[model samples]
Target: MNPLLDERKATVEADHQWIANLEVDERARTGIPLLKVGFNETFGYYISISRAKADQVPANYIRKQTLKNEERYITPELKEREARILTARDDLHKLEYEVFVTLREEVGEQAEAIRHLSRAVAAADVLCGLAELAVYQGYCRPEMVNGRELKIVDGRHPVVEQSLPAGFFVPNSTELGNIEETSPLPDLIILTGPNASGKSCYLRQVGLIQLMAQIGSFVPAKSARLGVCDRIFTRVGAVDDLATGQSTFMVEMNETANILNHATSRSLVLLDEIGRGTATFDGLSIAWAVAEYLAMEIRSRTIFATHYHELNELAGMLPNVANYQVTVKELPDQIIFLHQVQPGGADKSYGIEAGRLAGLPTVVIQRAKQVMGQIEKHSKIAMGLREGL
Candidate 1:
């Protein structure tokens, strides 16, 4: 569309090629195969020759620079070519900017129409992509309702399922609140299990299903009936924000506080390892209090995934709170993660087994087990004393 730009670009390229050709001819004429043509800001296009070949330079090569082991020289022809090349670049830039301004003005005339068409195209692209995903991945349309009920039968993680082979990613079901004649489920689910038993994945799955349903897209489930939520809040994983001068624990508490302050009965909250960055008892205590608050005060649909098995007591105390665990098959030497979330609270986290599977040294693993045993013994005694007191 711009002939001036094309012509200027060709001129620049041809000038550069001329310098390269000049170097090749000079190398052959002077019998210096190591001669190179280069350009720097301080010294415009110059031919570099090693000190050993200083005597071999042609008479027309005027010395421009002297390095530790090389001498740079520029011929009169090369100097003139350099000036043209440099000026042509500046002219090219100015011409390009002028052309750009002209094109931009032309585009600006139809800016409204362009924006309208762009919005339509973008919407169609998104819808087509989602429809394709639904067809290929066997996603089911969710039945959204006005009431506070979320039910999914055999739901899978949208992203994780795709990464695995077909039918490899296990699907799990979730039910909360009452729908029609169905019995009411808990508002808050206390999810506990071993270190790598898919508790976090299950929590994320529920949140994603709810989000996908609300966005008018088919969810990655065999069947689902979801209620529209005002907001979906998540506090997952621990990462210290050093730039903001906040530790991992501080970040966790800040997010938790935000969820508690703003979340309502119509909100969906997904929390994972809420207070594991602090001391064991401190973390457990905070997790317990957070779960209780979400169940009682906020009354939000929550999936609290934590290693604190003690929080399972909330299910016993709170009517709106329930307990779920990612089941595992314990073997003699190791544990197999079932990746199945079922109703019940796990008594053990099996952290040492996880560490062992992660390839910790035998001595370290044994020492960890010993320490764990002692801690459990002391915890039981402490509980007994507290109960008595």
Candidate 2:
């Protein structure tokens, strides 16, 4: 049996249970009897209106308001019949009240039981979720026969695909070499590309794929060979913690530190735009050090996406590091994302073009272009001076 597919099936079944419990709770709150109540004796009594009437009757009926002045007294035969009927009715009412009370109590107990069951189902779902995510990770497990490498082919991001507008998804593939079984594993992949070129999306795809595999679902990839990972870590966006009195950079660093400390060799780590919350030099230095630590120290499979061009040099220096850039086609006054990953680092980031794409005015676009050119020239001169020094 395919363990990954089995895991996904288990997850769907568990989720169905949770869905059932929700429906049960909603019905219980509204006093709608569950079909399962058919098995109970109280439900049998409630099903028949004749039984309900026999069970309870209002006492001391006047019978007629116009006959109040008349000498309306109970006849001996009528009184005798009334006594017998009232006595039976009172007993039945007591029984019916008991049934109602018991039903209420049972509802509470059933709700609690459903709650406990739902929690168990949710826990199982988490495990299944993990297995499903493994389907996208390209890490191959050793084959049962001769330890052959398995491959993960053309994996798409399931969530991203669903969220994107129709006809916009771009497919990408990841694979491991089978013949060269001893080839070095791809541990650290550095993604460099222009802004809005799908760098973050690609990083997220990797993370999501692993997560889905762990949960035991079919991944968006056409095919996948996944090694079960211990944990998946992501340090993507930065937000200021005003209450904690920490800057955005500080918050980012804190998260990074947590991931670094907790992530194991079997973990999958995704770092996006790391160090961007601080100054260029400081951020670049931190990003470089973090990359080195992940590559040399942890040796975990990682995807690091950033705009720092200097850091891309690590692809040449580090053994397991590889540089991948998102492809973009530049037009006369516009840019389009090819949504494809290619070899080598990106030389330029078209921030102005991105701004224009976001509907910036013509004057602003022209000014941004001029400023960008000046910055590029200054950056080059500064690098040249540093090299000379």
Candidate 3:
């Protein structure tokens, strides 16, 4: 008989009755509380006890099984009845499998409808999750604009801030173009700060905020005004594609070329440490020209984060270029990263101090400071020669 038939109700009720009657309690002859009582193929039914109280078992309790920690036993009554029921169930299993296949195909006929409904339910769950995250993180709804100008108030890097301890991650503000500026092309900000400061975080935050808003989600910011963007281009960290035989510098140039070729005025570009894979002068010159290209030609709202303070000179040279730096406080012995972005370029790169914090040798740090002093003195002397000419 098919298990799905109404006549099989009697059989299911019989199984329930058999299971209910087979119930055992912790008050067994072992005098130790039974931790678990369950059944499986190898162990039909078992009662477990702690090894500490194994000595308390009565002499009549014939040990059917022995583990390192505990013992198992079975009364003759349980084994006899269980064997009769198992023989019948084994025969029923083969017949039941064929019936199950037919029932499954009947259900499979409706799979397309079920799949569509599952998709709808999944989409609802995702929206609910995003809503909960927005509420929990105190994210604000970003305002969308038709033009290319981004403004974020007290924005934070979502992933970085979450990884830090509560209240440890500092927030920063950004603006690509002022609401009152009324310019067609949004100005680009040149972000210069010491190594290990929050310049990269700031650049990433802007891109993420814009992306989140475009997707109809709240952003990680106190408030944000997002400009229309066809695409958000990023040339941030680099990695050599050794399998493809491309060097790190080649990869960097390829990404930079991609941005230069495709980006438009409405694009938001985030560039970090660009042209840094080559020598000093070559890297500086490329970084300088790339910043100029974005500001002068592409006019995309951009954040160009770099150690090359030389690029900061574009702030005065180009109308759409402005300078910003991550604020850090210098102590007698150590520098504290405030993680605050403010207007103007950093006076120095603080590379030696950054190296000191990176666990470099003290002698190397001192030697670097001396070398920096000498470079500055020679720079002034060279300037004197140019003035004399």
Candidate 4:
């Protein structure tokens, strides 16, 4: 990067040429083809002549060291040349270091200006990308308001839609909080459906749309009018924190407590399978209480996605609660995932069908069916207990 660096490098290389030529010249003078110039840290430079030809060396060659098979010698001229080489190399290195320090200081002086420019360039890059996405993906600009409302018509997940073929990704609508003329939409939606029915995708879509709208970017939707949210809280998957010695259920409870402690009416909360990490009854009770609190107390624009069909009862008890499900088509032998979110709750999760599709053993599937029938027959007691809660 600096011209001085190149100049010093060339000078050092040029100085090394003399040492090589000395080796050739000494070999010719001493009539010993084995005469050579070598350098080491202990002895800077020397000419090595084999012991048999040591007597033939020129008288000007003062002995520096002797070995069993060779004698190391240094002439006055060689010493002078070695000193010059060492001094030139030292000066060159010092000059190169000075050049680097100067360049670094200059960059440090412009650090603030460079950082400001970088931020501006980064922001421009993001806006350019969003603009290109809007043009190609047919995204719409959402209307942003200051109320507790979020409505999206025919919205698709921005990332998921890209993975799917064109016209294949089913678009779903979301309505929350109040719209002017229509009946007041629910503040909290209890999303129930079969496993892998795209419930998580749908929840993410709504959150992404709301975030895109607030950030002045077009949303992946046909139309949207989103209220500005103070925050977006999400608890989507299960993971154990082994480093902290916390089980999956404990980690889930910690995150849930944090959300409940900080979430407000102006926030958007997306929860998935809130209590599946614990026992059935314990999990059900916690899920029910969490849904009820989010709906009645915090009044956050929330989507509670769960396999707990019993949660549907919250819609009848809480005025700001509603039920939604991702529908499926059930055949005699198997089920088809429709991946369509619509009103009303689903009673069955069709998890056994999912296992069957996943290639579970036939005997295992059959035994699971029998076990499920027995569990359902006794589930009335659990249902009654849930109603009491």
Candidate 5:
């Protein structure tokens, strides 16, 4: 364009006349006119007509757009001029684009070096952020090892606790791997508690701490001795994936099966309500067997949170299985969530109590309590039979 020849300049000048001044009615000063011409990016060129004078438009006019008060048309002569102008503009643009693509390819020759530098910078940036987080959050450096012994003292959920009132987020501890003289493998925690307790948060916090430690980042713990895990599997909650044609129970079972299939002793598994998605007896049986397999066959460090209080019996039956509960303090009329994790099994799930606390209808609460009592009585008898007592 800078040094175009005489012929090219003359051709460029001729092309400009194509769209320079589209035809319009000079009678527009008085009122809306029937015939007019316009050019825009969308339709390129069109003739406008007012409904009152639409009959005066030429028969050769091709209707392109219709409006409430008027219609737009394109004539053959206008269309031919538009096509020529557009073709010339497109050719110029394509030539420029080709030049740009060639230049881009020359720069792409150095793409490999750029990508390596980018990865290094990204890693450095992540480390800088982690270091800042450690300093601000009072995180301590974790001691990482390979041979079992997963321990974390006073560990807090990094994100969950930050939003809580200061010192309100309870710091819990975790200990896995059988250190006993006669034991065969690591221990599995059977976590049980009422709804809305810190059981889920505690489970996630343990996994997060271990993951952070293994990745060479300081963890949100007073002290941590982490065992390097090959994989960290978590099945926390369920939802019906109807679009995928799977029920809530099916989704839960699939995820549970995946964990059971691939998880090794070196893996860390956090299972929340393994079989609560299905029928009571079926769910309980599956959950009970899954825990046993994890403890005996896979021997992985696992935190199993559940609403099934009956699963607590695993502590007595399996040596590698231990029980833990998120304790709640009962008030005169309301139960306060303590959010504390402590040793031993829970006496009750406190679901009805929790519903009552959540402002459930008084009549419903009373009926639930009555039904729970009947269920418990029958469950105790069934349990005795299962134990052959």
Candidate 6:
């Protein structure tokens, strides 16, 4: 399985709450049956009555009658009797209409208030929900556990970490160095390893950390120093665009190109198996050039995972370029991945051993071994000849 795609899917899954809240807000604004009633309930009666009696002449008639009655108050008993009669007459229909109109106006104001309030409330809800989910799913800490800029201790995959049994799933921690006020943020991190290593997992962890930070949650490291980023670009999965008539390799290159053109120093980029979509030599050349551009031009925080060992040469020339490898210890015919990330380049790609784990046919495995030996011998001979020339 493609680890990069798996990580992206996991991130999306963990953020289910934020997505749900967004959907709710969209429905509410568009009048798509919100979960709770708004000002409509409070003002329904006022609006209904106003519409029903809008054409009535009772209000005008009562005003004229009251004016005429006010002019005949001369004797005390007669004045009292006249006042009572006038009050009763005014109360008949005009009072009700006045009360209804007043109530309608008040309700209209309330409805407008609710409309304005919904937007702010919805945005806050979404941001809070994202943070809460990050903590709950183990992508990041629920609260700031350390005084440091960021800290994540024993954090696991927000999604995969959930499926594991209660006591399983190891946690990893990260923090910036204390000597430097801020961590040395590299423009590029080159990750090299054989198949089935944890390079993809490490890349995913970084992406998840940034996502949590953006949503205003503590990260999964024991301590973290975070610089806010504007955009996160991931180019991990490779698939042919059948609709566009582009090959898988072309699609991959297009994504890479887009990233190069658009990503800024504040962006976070994760690239996995960058050149696997094309021919070996061509893919290596493109991958090498992309890495160089990220290091020299974009200068963004980037995590690039690939099987190409040639790219490791960047460490010598690029100041901020760091080499990391997913470690594996091998026996004669068995291999075990430590699932650990350490500084430096990997020396070998154990493809045959990985194929063995996948249970390839015995004959195929044997032939592969033979072919591999022949290729290595020929490569050595060619190198010697070139040196002589």
The lDDT of each candidate is 0.89, 0.66, 0.79, 0.91, 0.83, 0.64
Please list the residue runs of candidate 1 whose C-alpha ends up more than 4 Å from where it truly belongs after superposition.
1-99, 178-182, 381-389
**Model 3 Cα lDDT, one tens digit per residue, 229-348:** 899999888799999999999999999999999998888899999989999778977888898888888888889999887677777667788889998999999888888999998867
Off by over 4 Å in 6: 1-155, 172-185, 378-389
Candidate 2 scores a C-alpha RMSD against the true structure in Å of 14.8
TM-scores of the candidates in the order shown: 0.75, 0.63, 0.74, 0.83, 0.74, 0.61
Between candidates 3 and 5, the lDDT winner: 5
Give the poorly placed runs of model 3, Cα more than 4 Å off: 1-96, 177-186, 380-389
Model 4, range 1-389, lDDT digits (tens) per residue? 87777877887787788887998888887899999899999999999999999779898999999999999999988998888889888998799789889989999999999999999999999999999999999999999888888989999999999998899999999999855545789999999999989999999999899888889999999999888999999998889999989999999999999999999999999999999999988998899899998988898999999998989988877778899999999889878889999999999999998898899999999999999999998878445745676
lDDT of 2 by residue, 63-136 (tens): 22122222111223334444454454555556556667877898887997889999999988876764555454
Worst lDDT run of 10 residues, candidate 6, spans 42-51
Residue 219 local lDDT, model 3: 88
State each candidate's clash count.
0, 23, 0, 0, 0, 9
What CA RMSD would you report for each candidate?
6.1, 14.8, 7.7, 3.6, 7.0, 20.2
Ranking by lDDT: 4, 1, 5, 3, 2, 6
- On the 0 to 100 scale, the lDDT of residue 330 in model 2 is 82
TM-score rank order: 4, 1, 3, 5, 2, 6
In candidate 1, the residue pairs with backbone N, CA or C atoms under 3 Å apart (3 or more residues apart, or in different chains) clash, namely none
TM-score of candidate 6 relative to the true fold: 0.61
Best of the candidates, TM-score: 4
Task: Report the lDDT tens digits of candidate 5 across residue range 1-389.
Answer: 32333444455467666545445332353244545667789998887878777766666778899889988888787788777777766665666677678778987999999899999999999999999999999999998876788989999999998898888888998899765557543379999888888888998999899888988899999999887899999998778898999999999999999999999988999999888877888988898889889998999999999887777888877788899999999877778889989888887888898787789999999999899889777767337635852
Estimate, for each residue in 1-389, the C-alpha lDDT of model 6 and write its tens digit. Answer: 34444554454454443334543653454343422211123221110112223233222112111122131112233234344544544553465566678778987879978877998899889878766865665443445332222234555555556677874655554332122335553567788887877677777877787687667766655455566667889997768999999999889989998999999877778999898877877887788889989888877778889888767777767776778888888777788887776678886778888888899998988999999899777754323323442
